[model samples]
Target: MGRLTWIGIMVALAAGFSAGAVFGPVLMPRPGAASNPNLIDLSALPDELREKHRNEDFLRNEATNYAHMQEALAQRAAERAARAPLDLPNGMESVPFGLVYKPGGDVHWPEGMTGELGDALEAAKDGWVILNYWASWCGPCVHELPEMGKAAPLYADRGITLIAVNTDPMRKDTPDSARALFASKGIESLAPYVAEGTAVDQMMAAADMTMANVSLPTNIIYAPGGTPYAVFEGGNLSDSPVWTAPQTLAFLDVLAKGE
Candidate 1:
């Protein structure tokens, strides 16, 4: 069978494995299920089965998840490569969500954004920038924040930077508060930058977007050379994107490279 066919089979099997996690393996600090929602409750198993299969099941489930994720990534990458755009002004252009390609130009940040958040954006102008907006009150933002932090490191290797800016309105919005929140959430790898002072309206204006078109959990994407776009806006926990997922990394790699 061809490689794509093999990947398809593996993905299907992974779905089955994930569904059968109770009969499969993996555990977490949580009393019952594994940290990954995909895996089932380990503590619920019979005492002997839990003891006998704890390590083995964990290893098996992790290995399978990783392998399946990679296979899916490679298969999708192949399909994406086959459909890459041909025309470009400077021999290249911005591709957003692989949905549309446009002239890749320098993005202009609004003047009001003038601190750590602005500095972070300025420093990463040479590559892809993923600006994620989140507020403490927004349930969906809290759900996806940790996943984004976990994926931040992987993004650096692919020339992408994920800047998760907190817009929590209740607090004074200090650096220490931001760092504290990240620590509380177990997000150590990514920077602790809050954008409370920097209004969402400022960002929307910079991207030429209107309030009618935007909502909470707005993720503003900046293509290489600094073209800006907003997407993945207005979603609840059910719609949250797991940034650490392999498919996410692969899609990012494709977007970051403009390939």
Candidate 2:
């Protein structure tokens, strides 16, 4: 072969090899292949690129699973709500008293009260207390608060006081913003309680509740004499499929009747 002809052939072969290396996965199937041809072979990528792609896939799957879980919880709450006039049996176990902080900023509390949650509970010792943990950033919590406000008066008539404990931590504008939200939603009846410092951690530990893995609303139901009888975790009937205000009220009604 002439030298020029040999050089040209070698260059052509090199170009073909490069093209095949780049597009081979998509164009050709492996022997006895069961793998998806549409999916990129991440193993062939650089270490950093592979890690990035792996992380993206993990996050996508995580989000999907979370969404599915929320839907399931909402369905469950709906089913429970359909069974109206729910009631809790008597002699239910109770949790011990734990401290919570007073709602800060311009929100008002009774005169001469030191804004200690434990003390407030002690004062209302004879009534059923619904201690709701919420935050402004939490969409489900925001949706449920208005409903809770509407139910507050009726609950109070039945000796149940709905106290919303804001769990937004300490921020310059959090309390003001929370108060504004209450005003905007016309939530007049439910007293605002702030979870500050380590109060949230303490309250969660005391109530045996966990919001670590899931960002769901949690409420603690306390029977007369400050005994925490039940802990409702996850979304409310208003937003989530896990819990409903009606169910809570029914349970309280039974408690009020000493059932």
Error of 2 at 126 (Å): 3.1
Error of 2 at 135 (Å): 1.1
Q: Taking the tens digit of each residue's C-alpha lDDT, what string does model 1 give over 1-259?
A: 0000111322443443343444433443456534665455556667875564456666577567756666666764464345424343333343322233221232244446667777887888778888766656566667666777778889988889888876543345567876777889999878877755446556645543433322345566677666664344433354334566555666676676666
TM-score of 1: 0.52
- Per-model TM-score versus the true fold: 0.52, 0.51
Which candidate comes out best when scored by lDDT? 1
Model 1: ten consecutive residues of lowest lDDT: 1-10
> lDDT (CA) for every model shown?
0.57, 0.51
RMSD of each: 15.8, 19.4
Model 1 C-alpha lDDT versus the unseen true structure: 0.57
